[model samples]
Target: MKWYFVLACYLLAPAIAFCNSYGMGLTNLNLAPTYGKIALFVFSSLVGSDGGVIAGLAACGIIMSIVCSAADLMQDFKSSYLTLSSPRSLFVFQMICVAIGCIIAPLALWLFWTAFDIGDPDGEYKAPFAVIFREMAIIGIEGFAALPKHCLEICCVFFLAALIVSLLKDATPSHVSSFIPIPMAMAVPFYIGAYFGVDMFMGTLILFAWQKMNRREADGYAVAAASGLICGDRVWSIPAAVLSILRVDPPICMNFRPTSASV
Candidate 1:
């Protein structure tokens, strides 16, 4: 919450980025939640429990942002490596994007909050991640024993299964191991819901069709198309948020609900 804490986070960004480049990003991600909890515990001890939750949430955001930015930078570096492009240029571009995002993301959130009731359970945007984060923060503050029994059991099962699969994947031949389902990808739907999985499935099917049609052009076309789609999806969010601010409700927004009153 203090200015010094904020400055420390910025100063640590380059170190985080370096670690990620060397494949230590996963280690950082694994440790981040624990570190956040420790940071929150310290903040609570210093400031009392009254405003500690807000400070804790800010700490979580800062940690998550650093880890995510580093992971993204590593991805960009991989893309640049494959393309024989300049990593410095990519890093500069990413920094510019991060600066813009830091300004724009909060504005979009504020606009949406103003335009619609955000925290309502029945709202169009359920803010599922926010709910998850809040629950995690509570767990951090209280302790793991506070988590539901069934949730703990399920977590244990998945953790064991993931460990086994990771060992198996490493031991197996590369050609055979390529078929193994990514543990993270398999687990994503549990946290983010099935919509993202559905989108990924659809994209895979499209890519398959493209490869079948023309394997030669598929690589180039697929990369270009995927990049365009990713950019378009994010770019559209800005205008959509602007429209929300302008109170422009389109017919497409209404289509989310059923038209039949009988239902």
Candidate 2:
């Protein structure tokens, strides 16, 4: 199933490239950091398994990789389910949304580049997928042999850290498990560490300032702020909110599942 999805991505690569180049426009600021971790995970897993050097290590790396990517999607999904929205509908909506965005993105890029003609006169536009693939290759070359050692370190650190935190806070084991990966990813990767730190601090500050308000109210503010940032205009406020909802993945796998889910 996973391989099929990967193959499908390749099959649709041309369309995705065209969309990115011509339709919706592209910006390095937002997309680069978001996709970087994703690429790291993908590449690390693939490269780690190349020689079948360490079965256990490879397996753990793959799991961490999935957890890393899923964390990003899960946060957005969590926000979506907070409001009234159907889970199945939101899932389908994301599929359609990404398909459209991937197809139109290239067209948007071409226009932006042509308008500015600033950076590369050669019209060299690297699509998101290609960038991801390149990063994966780089990760493979760097850690292909040392994969087992790395994987052991990751698993040990992940569970031990989670356990320590859970014990110290009197939280459940599941709570620790659910919350551990995001911070773990940040620890090794400097760029991701900085970004997550900033984002978490901002979220904490917002929640602290709005301490008197209910969760629902704070959620509303966060959603509004996120929407405004994403849409670039108020006309997209509603749709952005809807997109936020659509992106939320159910927390069937986690203990910290938002209390707001209806389905």
Candidate 3:
């Protein structure tokens, strides 16, 4: 049975490598469902794993695959930081923070859904938040709804917060580690904030234009300009999204801090 499992993983290695090269984490995870089906078939063919035994093994493998994938993601982050010559001490601290951040993700999600009721009305779900609920439902099976809501809220909130801060502040893992609690405080969806950020930036451009024309407005106009900027920024997403699709790989480094001493 053990050898069979090893063989299965070996066969799947090529597929996994291809997915990784494409930077498709979701596609990689999706393969586990197929692997689960294949494992059951193998178990039945080789050792006569009956319904109960087969089901149990399949469940275990699926869980193990998710765990391994998440670990790989962490290692990827660690490698990226090292590639940029981040301090060893800072990297270790950030890893610890990342662990804490992972725990917080689900809890954050539960809270958001509880507060905003943000799910598909027909049960189809979306993203960082959906993952928490979907995994819980799968693992808990019969008792999924009975799971603690706070746990759901934390995880969803934490991951998004990390992504948003990474996007907006250009924070390094070290900076993220130091201000780990901020994401939990305001659980905005990362994409939503990003949209707003674009609008704000555009408004700023308009304001600068007006200022150059000697048409400076009152303080109230400043606030209005800010709002307009946020609205305009969403237009920028079209180009960014297109670029992301063209670029198969996500950028390895983000939120870099430069040395002013170079000046």
Pick the lDDT winner. 1
Task: Show the colliding residue pairs in model 1.
Answer: none
Candidate 2 positional error at 168, Å: 6.7
lDDT against the true structure, each candidate: 0.68, 0.49, 0.50
Candidate 3 backbone overlaps, count: 30
Ranking by TM-score: 1, 2, 3
Q: Which of the two, 1 or 3, has more lDDT?
A: 1
| Model 1 regions lying over 4 Å from their true place | 1-62, 88-139, 231-263
Give the candidate number with the greatest TM-score.
Answer: 1
**TM, every model:** 0.53, 0.36, 0.25
The weakest ten consecutive residues by lDDT in model 3 span: 21-30
| TM-score between candidate 1 and the true structure | 0.53
- Candidate 2's residue-wise lDDT over 144-257, tens digit each? 453566776786887688557646555557666565443323343354456445655665577767756677777668657755554564576688688778996545654555
Candidate number that wins on TM-score, 2 or 3 = 2
